[model samples]
Every structure is written in C-alpha cells, then in structure tokens.
Target: MLGLKQSDLASKAMITRSVLLGLEQPGRKHPDQLALFQLRDALIRDGLTFVDATEAAGEGVRWAKPSGKVWVDCLKDARAMLGYSLDELSEKSGVGRYVIARLEKTDRKRINEEAARRLRDVLFDNGVVILAEEADIGAGVRLRSRVRPAK
Candidate 1:
C-alpha cells in the first residue's frame, strides 16, 4: 500500500484514476509499462513480490527483465539508506539538480557517455559501487550498469 492513496498512485504512475481502479479490479488488463513498473516498485517497498511480465514471457519478447533491482532503484535506496536527500546528493556529487533528476527519472532514452562516466564516478565516490558495460545497439551505443551501496 506504500501509504499512498489511489489518486496519489494514479498521479505518480501517470495514469488516470479509472485506469488504476481498473487495474486493481480482478480480471482487468494490466497497466502499461510505466504504470506497471511504478506500481511494482511501490508494491515491492510494501513487501509485495511482483511477477514481472518479462520473466513470465521470457525469450518471447526482447524486453530486458529488470535483473534484481534496477540501478536507479539502488541509487534511490542507497540515498535513503544514507539519509541523504536529492539536494544533498547534488551538492555532494557536484551534479546539478536537473541532471540528477533526469538520471533518477531516466528521462532520456540515452545518456551522453561522458555524463554517464561522471555519474558513475560520483556515485562511486559516495560509497556506491557501479559497474558499467557497453551494450550492442543497432547503430547507437548503450550503457548498462549494476549499482549498490558499499556497506
């Protein structure tokens, strides 16, 4: 439940209330990608395990099933675990608020290589371990990483 109201969940999930209501009802079609992911994370925080579609549909679709927790989720959790806010992270990392927000939200489909490297360095400096790997893209390049906070 994450202590969030239905309307709040809908707003955060970027879907309409009716859509969220329908998703909550039995036998209704599941929410789309964004909403589903958001709802799954919220549920996970509340100790609920979500059966990811990518896992169930394995190999049929080329979807990257989120392996364990996502890097962004790790970042958010690490920050919270350290009792740091976005503003504090921004100041500590010397990364701008907008840039940090963009990274956290994954607003862009791709991030600049230099930016990604700098982000990796900053996170590492903050006791967060991050490993980046280059992924094959048809034409463009992609970077994938696993992140966790150092204990």
Candidate 2:
C-alpha cells in the first residue's frame, strides 16, 4: 500500500511473501512482533495510526499474546527497543551467557533470585517493565516468572 507490491513489502519487512499476503486477508493469524512492528511503521508512514492498523489487522483473532518469555522476552524487547544485544546485556547485567540461553529456552526451571533481580534491574534500566508474579505449587514454594512476553 506504500507504493510497493506485496512482494516488495515482504522483502522490506524481511518476511516471506506468504506472510504478507496472509496479513492482507481477513481472519488470518496475526503476525509476530517484528513483522507486526514493521507493518505498523509502514502503515503509520502512510498516514494510518498504529492502533487502528493493529485493530484492523487482528479483527478476528480472539486473543493475541504478548511477545517473549518473561525473562527472555523482556530482555529481547528491551534490547531491541534500546539497540542492544544478548552479549551486551550479559556484560551489563553480569549474567552468564549460558544462564541467559537457558532462561530463553523452554526447559528452564529455576533461576536464582539474585539473577532474576539483576535481570529485572537491567530491563528496568532500559525502560522495560518487569512484572513477576507467583503461583502456588502444592504445599511448597510457589512458581515465579511463569508467563512471559513472546519473542
């Protein structure tokens, strides 16, 4: 719609043409964060508000999840918005790369409280909000940082 063909837009957005076509058609699944943001920016440049474009695009989707895993997702979003990388975050936060990798993966079970606190601080310093909630687990300790933003 920005004087560019669907294929051109897809290429510019670094997504496949099928994704672009799917976004154009109604009732299709919503795009991921990167794609959604790229489309949003393009639409805004063409005089459409981001909220309106997002609403129009996701008209039929009953629920849309936030991007990223709690720790990983928050870090990714903050890094992207703040123009940093995993290595930079590790260096700045003093969290090991292996720990960061494990946290981003699905197998993560436990994270030290200190590490979690440090991560929260790093993300907050970058202007990202970190919300940690606890859920009950039997009669023992509760689970922490269960739900996170999508990547």
Compared with the true structure, all predictions reach lDDT values of 0.49, 0.50
Clash-forming residue pairs, model 2? 67-149, 67-150, 68-149, 68-150, 68-151, 70-148
Residues 8-122, candidate 2, lDDT per residue (tens digit)? 7777677889877777665565656777778766554543232111321211110022323344334443444345677887898998866766665445677566776786677
Query: Candidate 1's residue-wise lDDT over 36-143, tens digit each?
Result: 777666554444332222322211111123234334423443454345687987788777767766665534565555544565566555544432222521111111
Instruction: Give Cα distance to truth, residue 149, candidate 1, Å.
Output: 17
* Residue range with the least summed lDDT across 10 consecutive positions in model 2: 136-145
Off by over 4 Å in 1: 1-73, 131-151
Best by lDDT: 2
C-alpha RMSD values across all candidates: 12.4, 13.8
